[model samples]
Target: MPQTLFDKLWAPHVVADLGDDWALLHVDRVLLHDMSGARALTEVGERGYSLARPDLVFATPDHAVSSAPGRSSATFAGGARPIERLRQRVRETGIRLFDLGQPGHGIVHVMAPELAIVLPGTTLVCGDSHTCTNGGVGALAFGIGASELTHVLATQTLMQRRPRTMRLTFTGTLPPGVTAKDMILAAIGQLGTAGGTGFAVEYAGEAVRALPLEARLTLCNLSIEMGAKMGFCAPDDVTFAYLKGRRFAPTGAAWDAAVAAWRTLRSDDGAVFDREVAIDAGTIAPQITWGTSPEQVAPVTANVPYPAGPADQAALDYIGLAAGQALIGTPVDWVFIGSCTNSRLSDLRDAAAVLRGRKVAPHVTAWVVPGSETVKREAEAEGLHAQFLEAGFEWREPGCALCVCVNGESVPAGKRSVSTSNRNFVGRQGTGARTHLASPAMAAAAALAGAIVDVRSY
Candidate 1:
């Protein structure tokens, strides 16, 4: 029988088939962060259970850590308790932890791949929906709930239903200034947020195959935004090269063996999917969200959509948008170019290229938070920090700054921010604050103009 990439990665891990599409799938890696990790660990501890495979589990403090310069865990009001609890539990459980000020400290999704904690043909889970980001390296990754986390901790496996498979193939080349962020946003716009429900999506075709590893990571990072269980790109030489010499990646003979096995981790030539969609990458423009949901997106030149239904009208109201209002040139109060979705070095370089020799608008509060300390140091080496500082953008310490609003970082009430973060539910930034999602370049342009102008115009 022909096997898809998902099949190749999922089959070996299936320990039991419990009928009706359910199976017990072995979890190869388990990642936890401070926001939810502490509670889950405490629950298991209170129940008097020990981790089945402590060596396979890892924890980090990201969600509740302050991104303020020279920040301590206590920097954010209400942050210290969860962080301290996580430290105590991780110490008791014996799982490796990447705590604050550590090189491996970052958003769990960002740290997993860069540190090679996730690898090709593995099953990874975190108590984070964006754990799909690790799928970029060909891992089968998903977010599990607290109960499921406890289950994985005790059994090292999850009882799960098999998701139907979908393949979204992208053909043609993306135009300059259009990026992987644009491509995924365009798909969400076209397909609606629930379009990929009940499926695992594999991105393929010429454009996906051609994407650099970083871009591939960005593409997979948004799979959950579209309601998919996970999304992944097949691991090729590009994936192998990116993982080489990483802190946790295999070395020497182990590296050679790993690459050889990864080569066979793709779909067989004749394998079929339950559903498939093809996209013309050339047609995608720099995209931005106009409403609360990620699917309420349009190209930079587009207007806020007039309501097609009551739901659409409700979305417009929540976002403080008037029907048919033009989004381009609309004023924004802030600009943020950081998140687990787009705070990598490549994302920073692209935004910095636009910010060089330019100044931010006087009224716009702009910030750039790197995804990890390692990414921050590397960007500094390349002088990207100077470019942002000279342009009046606050360069923040690496963490989930302004993305999840968990650590006292937030947009002021009633202010609209153009942000590179994923998700823009009403008050996602703060009470009464509105968020407009965009690529790093688009966010940078908004910072410069104090308005949502087209990045191409810059």
Candidate 2:
């Protein structure tokens, strides 16, 4: 029988059929973060349950830890309690907790892939919506609620209904300054936020395959914003090359065997999908979200669109923008270049390239937080941090930072920001903060210009 990539990844993980498309699916990897890990671990202990597969569980403190340079767990007063509790529970349960300043410490989604903990053709779940970010490695990954986290800890399986399949193929080459961020944002703009509801999307075609592994992660990170729980790219040579020497990845003969098996993880010819969408990569430009939702986006050269309904009007009102106003030259007060979505080494390099021989505008406060401690070290080794610091951007430690807005970093109320993070929803960065989502290069350009500007022009 012909099967899609999702079908191949889903079938082998099914432990039992639970009727009506629901099944007991064995989970291959479990990631826990500071925001919810402590509570979930406490609940499991309260219920007198032991971790079914402690070896498969990895915990990290990212959401609640400060990203401030030289920050400790106590640096963020609001996060101190959660960080301490997470440390305690992990100690008791023997789950590996990548503590603050640790080499593997980072946003859960970022470090997991960086460490090769979430591999191709595995099932992973984290207590984070952006857990879908791991799907870049072709894993069947998704976010789970609090209860589901507890359940997964007590038993290495989850009760889940199989999602229908959707294939989004991006044909043609991307134009200069267009990126994976723009590609995904363009898809969401064309398909709307709810277009992928109830479907697991597979991103394929020339453009997707051309993206580097880190770029693919950025592409899949926004899957949740498009109303999909899971999105993935089939593993190919690019995937294999990226994983070949990473820690936790198979080594020696095992690696050869793993690659041999991974090669067969793609969709079989003639396989059918529940839905299919094709996008021309050449048509996508550097995109920025004009309103609250990811779908409320336009090319950087475009203007704020006229409202089609009350919802559109409300978004514009919240963002403090008028219909038909040009996005370019709009004043920006903050620029953030970090998040699980876009804080990798490559993202830093991209931003640094734009800031080289330039300076951030005096009115713009810019920050560059690496995705992980490893990324931080690598970037510094390459003098990327020097470029950003010389250009007037704060070079901070690795963590969620302003993307989650609870880690002692935030854009002030009513201020406009150009951010590389996934979402631009109201209050996502802080109460009443207005965020325009873009790529790292675009965010850097905004910081230099003190407003939104075309990266291409820079």
Each candidate structure's TM-score, on Cα atoms with residue i matched to residue i, is 0.98, 0.99
Backbone clash tally (model 2): 0
Q: Model 2 misses residue 288 by how many Å? A: 0.4
Candidate 2 lDDT by residue in tens digits, 195-292: 99999999999999999999999999999999999999999999999988898899999999999999999999999999999999988899999999
List model 1 lDDT by residue over 1-458, tens digit each. 88999999888999999899899999999999998798888988788888899999999888877888899889986889989899999989889998877888888888899899999999999999999988999999999899999999988999999999999999999999998999999999988899899999999988898888888989998999999979999999999999999999999999999999999999998898999899999999999999888998999888887889998888888778897778887899999988889999999998998876999999999999999888888999999999999999998888898988989888998899999988988888888888999999999999999999999988
* Candidate 1 global TM-score: 0.98
C-alpha lDDT of candidate 1 relative to the true structure: 0.91
Model 2 CA lDDT for position 330: 97
Please report, as a residue range, the 10-residue window in candidate 2 with the lowest summed lDDT: 348-357
The deviation in Å at residue 47 for candidate 2 is 1.2
